[model samples]
Target: MAAELMDGKLLAQEMKEELKAQVEELKSKGITPGLGVILVGDNPASKSYVTSKEKACERIGIFSDDTRLPDTITEEELLSHVDRMNRDDKIHGILVQLPLPKHIDEDKIINAISPDKDVDGFHPVSVGRMVLGQETFLPCTPHGCLKLLERYDVETEGAEVVVIGRSNIVGKPVANLLMRKDKPGNSTVTVCHTRTKKEDLLTHTKKADIIIVASGFPNTLTADMVKDGVVVIDVGINRVEDASRERGYRLIGDADFDSLKEKCSKITPVPGGVGPMTITMLLFNTVQSARNRLSK
Candidate 1:
């Protein structure tokens, strides 16, 4: 039997509907969830991502305050914008797009955002809180992955899970999340990076009941590397040239999707999979921040 396709686009739409209702409820309580977005450069990919996020905010009725700064802006100027947003009572969440100009210190910019409004969940305080399993905003992509598993009714508790890649963004955080004593967690996780010995990597993968590959390279996890009935989440999105497509390239994930689908019990596809959930979760975190503000 072919694997059950985990349609992230469908799930994201469903989640947006839920969040829209939540936003309306917040509005009734005299609080409109607001997000502050700062784009520091003209990088095309960053611009596209920012646009998508802003559109999502609109659809969900979250107020968005967007700032576009030239790449030539000084680091101090960037920090000042973050600080201004930090003090803005209406702005419940602050998001500074990553990969700023080379001159700016990315770490310093990330640190400047108040942890309470750090909806991106990249601040050191948020990361530490997450590591300690305290309630905090999670990195959107990894949080989206967990939502997929939970919604699909995947049995994660005590299951053997192998995560490929070690980037702070997806790999490390997701691994930590899976081992927590919570729903969609309590799984034994093994992370394989470029440095992991091939034999050891194979050993862990072959025994895993679930594999989440985000190595950012094509075919990093092949069908042969997993056991029967495994669930695979392919987080890597890479562009590969293909003359057959209109765009001259196709999007693919880290796993060998064509083959893995035949052998796995469930899998998420590339463009339609984890991609959609990321933005949805970002909206989620922003709304959550607004909800938190009501308690104060």
Candidate 2:
């Protein structure tokens, strides 16, 4: 039998509905969650992502402020804008889109956001809090992946999980999350990256009850590499040339879904998979930020 689809789009919609209800409650209590997005340069993909985020905010009844700067913008100018958002009482969450213009210092820009308002959860403080398993904003993508597992009722406790990527954003944080001593966590995790031997990748993946691939390379995880009945989460988003498509390209994940799906118990699709959940988690984090502020 083919693997059951992990419907991230459906789960995201459910979470968004919950957030919308919470947003309404907050509004009734005189609290309106606001998200500030800082975009630099004119990368078409980044522009499209920002637009989608803004639309999500509108749906949830949250206020969204978008700051778009030219490609020529300097690091100092970007920092200035982040600083302003940090102090803006109306804005509870501040997200500076990644892949900043070459001229700007991305680390410095991420550091500029107040920890309380770092909805993107890229700051060191947020990372540190996550490490300690404290209540802080969880990085959206990894958080979303975990949520997907929970919604699907996948068995995580004591399971051997292999995550193929080591980036701070998805791979490492996800490993940290799964290794945590908590529910949906407490699993044995092995994170593999480029330096890892090819034999090691197969060795670990073959034994993994859950495998997450985030290497941004199309078809990186072949069907033969994974064990039967493994739950696969494909976090990679790669654009490959497709002559048939109108744009001459299509989105694909690291896993060879067509071949690997038959070998797995559950798996997520590329476009409708981890992608939607990332945005929904962003809205969830913003709602939490607003609620925390009100409680304080």
Candidate 3:
């Protein structure tokens, strides 16, 4: 039998329905959850992502303050905008779109945002809190992946899980989350990366009951690499040129879904998989941040 599709789009809709009720209740209590979004350049993909986030915020009745800046803006100018958002009483969560212009310092900008309002959860404080397993904003993509595993009953406890990337954003954070001493955690995680020898990589993957691949490269994981009945989360999204399509390209994940589907017990598809959940979780963090403000 083919692997069951872990439909993130459906789950995101369900989560949004729950969030709508939470937002309504917060409004009844005189608190409107607000998100301040900053986009530093006009990269088409980044713009599209930001637009989706704004739409998601609107759908759930959360306030969004969007700032679109030119590619020429200096690091100092961007920092000023971040500082402005930090002090905005109505804005509970702040998100700065990634891949800023070459001239700007990404780390400095991320560090400038207040941890309390770092909805993207890229700030150092948030990372530290996540490592410590404290209640803090979890990185959206990683958080979404973990949520999918939990909702789908993936049996993470003590599972041999291999994560195929080590980036701070998805791989590292998700690995940390999986090993935490908590439900949906307590799994033994081995993270494979570019540095891992080919044989060593296979050795780790062959025994993994669960694998989360986020290497940003297509076909990083295949059917032969994972065990039968494995649960796979494909986090990589790479565009491959396809002349037959109108857009001239298609999105694919790191895992070879066709081959892997026949072997693995479960998997998440590209485009409709982790992508939707990432945005939904961003909205989740924003709502949670607003609720925190209300309690303060």
Candidate 4:
């Protein structure tokens, strides 16, 4: 069977168009949705990701307050910045770019952001609400994964699903989301982690009707490990050496696309798949945060 692409780029564009219209409507109501981003250091990949988010905010008519800080900034200084944004009436959402300098306490920074403006959904409060299936900002990557499956009309109810990761950001949330008693959920879910035995991991994967891979490494899902006709959503974004490319490197997903494409019913690609969806959902959550304030 020739596998069909999930086409996250296309779906993300559609979602952005819808959000743009919402932004216009909110503007007419004399409200401008705003997002404040804290970017520390100058990591190239993080900078690129932040730029993409800024462009997305512009496209959707959301106001962006992009703040750049030095790598030497103290954790207390970062928290002070977050505190100021938390009190800013114009800023409805706050996002701290990940992989902050090693000297900084990541959890303390994440905890400093108010739950109401925590668009990245890493705050303990947001995570707790999500675990209880309450209204809250969902983490962009996992939420984007669900949105992709929903938009593509994939069957999740009663389906056997294997998630190959355990990270709090993507794996834990997505697993909880898939097993919820709701559409695009209700799947019999199994999550494989680092401690999982190779044989056990393959056994769970081979029987799953859908496999969501966020293993953070390439080649985690091989063709032989899964059964034919399984649906695959690869969330991994790994950089590997590629002399043939102009940049001397290439981006790849967890699943072996070339070998698995012919076997799976549907699959998402590396550069254009989950990556785009993740950023798009960040925009979605920011918009939602702004809208929530209007009703208050």
Q: What TM-score does model 3 achieve against the real structure? A: 0.99
The predicted structure with the larger lDDT, 1 or 3, is 1
Worst 10 residues of 2 by lDDT: 101-110
lDDT per residue as tens, model 1, 93-156: 9999999888999999999999999898899999999999999999999999999999999999
| Models, CA RMSD each | 0.7, 0.7, 0.8, 0.8
lDDT agreement with native, every candidate: 0.95, 0.94, 0.94, 0.93
Query: Candidate 3: which pairs clash?
Result: none
Query: In model 3, where do residues sit more than 4 Å from their true spots?
Result: none
- Give the alpha carbon lDDT tens digit for every residue of 93-182 in model 2: 999998997777889888889999988889999999999999899999999999999999998999999999999999999999999987
Q: lDDT value for candidate 3?
A: 0.94
TM-scores for all predictions: 0.99, 0.99, 0.99, 0.99
Candidate 3 all-Cα RMSD: 0.8
- Model 3 residue 18 CA deviation (Å) reads 0.5
lDDT of 3 at 14: 99
Please give the lDDT score for candidate 1.
0.95
